[model samples]
Target: MRQHEAVINVMEEHGGYATLGFLNQEVLKVKDCVWKTKTPFASIRRIVQDERFFFKIKPGLWALKSYKEKLPTDILPTKEISKSQKEEFNHTYYQGLLVEIGNLKKFQTFVPNQDKNRLYLGKKLSDITTISDIYKFSYDHIVRMTQTIDVTWFNERNMLASLFEIEHSTPMYNSLLKFIELQDFYTDFRIVADDARKKEFQSKLSLEAFKPIIKRVGFWSYNAVAELHSKTSELISIESKLRL
Candidate 1:
């Protein structure tokens, strides 16, 4: 195959992302093609310069325009970009999609880490009710929920029900506080959970407090996924313990 085709094949094999150095090493083996021809380093750069090919990711690497992007919105129409803007938009759109997908995937992968922790506790909310239950549930939920895949899925009803179940036995304020701690404003259910409580609890904790926990869970799960960076784009801090 030609030099460019070989490079494209490498990008295709690695999920549309690759380092330039890695691509260069692969191109050296072609028999008829020189180390410079079959896998010519400049050819990769040349291919990217063309409009038909776009850089879908970076610091990671690139892919073809046909690759599916896991962005919140679909790619804008090609016509949306002026002739000159097509290349720019392609880069812009690719970066946007990468960030969006990275964020969601970070959140998605977070759940399994907590899953292991919750599984260890042996007392998931589905299995409990009453004040004491709430107390235990809160502790478990706080640690586990931080790694929850879908924060938006929780509601005040469920949160309250979980609380009621916990309340039946114990009155651990810390657990209730932890429950309130896991919420985020972006999701509807979280908003309800935030609103269900008295103003004191609602107003006390800042949004930033909740984020680090969620991000840590996200990072933990992300670490499990691969060598790629975690969802939070940072390493997970091991400061908090998941006590049952």
Candidate 2:
């Protein structure tokens, strides 16, 4: 098979649509296609932008031009849906990406109780996540605060590896406050939001109130997270192939 044909075939298998992240994970697995370059991932990125074969639906998501009108409503919501509906889809979509990334990295992931029942792609967020309950790594009050974080990655020791809050439409400040409670622990504090909101995030993080944990806090734009998830999955896939 031709190289672009491999990507197209994968998208077709996925109902004519696939996230760039999803492509990174699956496209290279096609045995009939050969990736002769040192940067197959970069090649895949370039191929998805070809426009002749695929069209971008949103950040990190692409679909075959042939299935544009046939896509499921939830995959590509119509204008008739409320703004909040679109926000929820985006929110859970990123959450699902994070959970899958953490799982591939061999970490236990968790989502808030309120979000447990929410859909991430076609599966419930809770079902995809490794743990149903948050680890009791700290005091009751602290655990209470941490449990509500949008998504968390816990190390094998059951301590927090990272804490991510998807601030889709919410204030980044509130998420920062939650990070404050765990300053003593070595944890990666991330605010996942739109790249456009990066300035707003920087402005809030500059406040003196957040100074103590300021150095540890970081911002991850939605696109950044999506790309990271893609690259991580690609790396893992390569390693697994080597074992074969």
Candidate 3:
């Protein structure tokens, strides 16, 4: 029986015990290991392909027999998200639809307190060119415009077309405050949130603090936004066809 030359070489270099750890250490020391063996290349390939064996030969190095012992249990598992994460995801989803609506209306959309560097809803709405002079728009003015509003669309005349606040899982009080601040302006004010929260919205609106502006504000569900988006798209398509 002829022994593989590579195995013989490893034994000769390491003396007696060519343990897996010892072989790995020797392989690390040498830049490359030239195997002088009668073993067929096909046989070598088969052995290397086996998951049980960790044999890798690269341009400048060769590692043979590096096996990690399997643990009894999984080291990593899927994790459950926190309430804040769910709320954030919901907020992003509703804000994305508002961004689409602004685009369809051909109005400049602004997301106050948004990081322009962060990419959301295809492209950041803050990065898009707006009709409002950003340099001239004061911080206080932007705060008043966006306070708790998730999205605001303005025409070229710098007049507000629509104001939107996505309540998601958040309390409606802050959004209502923003609506009250800008209610004097003639524009559509909408609170977009989950349909399940309709009663919660009504309850908040019934409060004495919110009574004065309750009639001015409107509520929209996620489904409502989707329907409006679809209708707006259809309208734009029809207008384009008429132009042709």
Checking candidate 2 for backbone clashes, the offending pairs are: none
Every model: Cα RMSD to truth: 16.3, 1.8, 20.2
Candidate closest to the true structure, highest TM-score: 2
Ranking by TM-score: 2, 3, 1
lDDT over C-alpha atoms for residue 204 of model 2: 96
Off by over 4 Å in 3: 1-83, 115-122, 127-148
- Name the lDDT value of residue 166 in candidate 3: 83
Query: Model 1 over residues 1-244: C-alpha lDDT tens digits?
Result: 7666666676666555444434444544445444444424456556655557556343324456656463211233233456544443333322222222333333211112222222111223222211111222246656454433221222333332111101111222443344446443233111111112434334433345444433222111211222232222212211111221
Give lDDT: candidate 2, residue 68: 87
lDDT of 2 by residue, 1-244 (tens): 9989999999999899887878887898899999899998899999999989999877778889999888876678888888998899889889998999999899999999999988765679999899999999989999999998999999999999999999987888899999987899988999999998999999999999999987898899988988888888788878887873
Give the TM-scores of the predictions, in the order they appear: 0.27, 0.92, 0.58
* Candidate 2 global lDDT: 0.89
lDDT of 1 at 8: 65
Worst 10 residues of 3 by lDDT: 69-78
lDDT (10s digit) by residue, model 3, range 75-108: 1111465666545545654565576668877887
